[model samples]
Target: MDRERLIRYLSLLVIGVAAVLPFVLEANLYLLNVLILMLIFIIFSSSWNLLAYSGQGSLGHAAFFGIGGYASTLIAVQSGLSPYVTIFLGGAIAAGIGVLIGLTCVRLKEWFLAMVTFGFAIIVQAITVSFLASLTGGWDGIASPRLVSSQVPGYILIEYYSILAITAGVILLIYLIFKSKIGMAFLAIRENEIEARVSGVDPVRYKLLAFAISAGLAGVAGALEIHYFGYITPEIYGIDISFWPIIYTILGGLGTIAGPVVGTVVLTILWDGLKVFGLTYERYIIIGAILILSVIFLPKGLVSLPDKIAGWWKRRQKKSPDAGT
Candidate 1:
């Protein structure tokens, strides 16, 4: 078999093993929480990776994320809809907004465009806090009904496995997308917009499509969060929320597929471990340090580290293989 097929099969085997892990391992509440949180960030980081890899560094993505959370929660609670359906609706709404905003600013440069999108995020947060009192619960945000109860050990296992399933599905979907012709188009646009446009690739349509899809996926994550945690607050939608995705992506590797997973695992472990030492608030410091070191030493992220090491080791072997003789 070729290298790509071998790698794909191996990766799938690993994921399949992980999906059934909770069944073989002992069930513990703390471990369950960690897994759930990891799943949440997995969704967040991967979606953000799509946009970042596509060359649109949006700082305002939290707007759609917040919208998705609120929309799903409100629909589930107020409108008396199923949590499942509301989730998709929330994502759709967020995506719709993304389409509009992406179309509006598709022409802007990276930094300036980021700033404009940041402004939009700020606006969304403020609106959620302001005179939309009846709808948004004003300033405090809305509280959601619990989607699960009892927190039994079996239920915890179920939740863990459910998250595993969702995460797997999302990762697979994205992997397929990136493997297709559209993924190549996105990469071309990222590498050089001028050249892509000159070659007849329509930048506006694809950028808007990416933005909408990214926001929609983020919405799915946010909605799942509300259901998983059984609560929602405006604070969750604040600018503070954006930092997590940004840090996770940068720490993992900006463009590589595995970077987000690596980043999420490392940071999640660090965050949980430090809580025991009463350094919970300092999670950001460690994460920031990781980001800085990642940028300085491994600018492509941890995903590229193995490849670089392998290349170096091969060169060394070629140079010194007969030394032992």
Candidate 2:
């Protein structure tokens, strides 16, 4: 089969597995909760990947993530709207802020841009706790409504399926975006901004667009997470939250759609698996080692491992005849 067709089939298989996984596990609430969080991080990681695709990397994505959560929670509480409706509205608010952030970042690149974004997260966190404390509840945090009330029968199962569907939809939307002219523009800009401009691609426009979309998606992920946990805090903007997506994307494959999904799944498993063995803080050491090794040996991320192995095998086979001679 052709590569594209194979990928299409593989994508469907993954989705199918996710669809039936809750049933396969007999609706175990613990596993379902884990899967739901996994799906949310997948969305979050994919959003980071999209920004990276535009040749921009952020170190403060938690800014948007927390913003979405706080905005959605506030809107839901005051307006008495469903969490479902407020999630998208919160995303929209994040997108607006993302555009404003993008304006300052379009001219900067690499570490400079990263530090700016990192600074924004800190600034945002401070604002949330100090300035917006009246509504946000300061360092104490505020309660959030659950996506589905626990009063409902099998609510955990319902939440899983709901998040799973949203994850699939988000993936599909990202796929479409990646296959469009906009995707091409992003690639060109990433490769060579001057050349892209010469070719009539507006780097500034596309970069802002990338920021808006990426931040908006991240906002949705954040909203989903807080609603799932039934709380939102300034801790939502923690450094760890910002770094997780970057780690997932780098380990999975920076530019590929499946990279975030693959990376998140593998790392989540490894992370939780180690905890089961009472590793605790030691798990970070192991994970850090693995990430370093992956960078040195599998820089393209886990998604490229199969191809790397295949090529190595081909080279070995070619040398076999010479060795005999």
Task: Tell me, by lDDT, which candidate is best.
Answer: 2
Candidate 2: worst-modelled 10 consecutive residues by lDDT: 316-325
- Candidate 1 lDDT over 225-325, as tens digits, reads 88788778777667767778887888888876777777887888888887878876587687677678878988877778888899998888789968546
- Displacement of residue 99 (Cα, Å) in model 1 is 0.9
lDDT of 2 by residue, 1-325 (tens): 5999999999999999999898899988788878999999999999999999999999999999999999999999999999989999998999999999999999999999999999999999999999899999999999999999899998888888888888999999899999999999999999999999999999999999999999999999999999999999899999999999999999999999999999999999998889899997799999999999999999999999999999999889888876545
TM-score of each: 0.91, 0.98
| Full-model lDDT, candidate 1 | 0.80
lDDT (Cα atoms) of all candidates against the true structure: 0.80, 0.95
Candidate 1: residue pairs that collide: none
* Candidate 1, run of 10 with poorest lDDT: 145-154
- Summed over model 1, clashes come to 0
RMSD of 1: 2.2
Cα-based lDDT at residue 286, candidate 1? 75
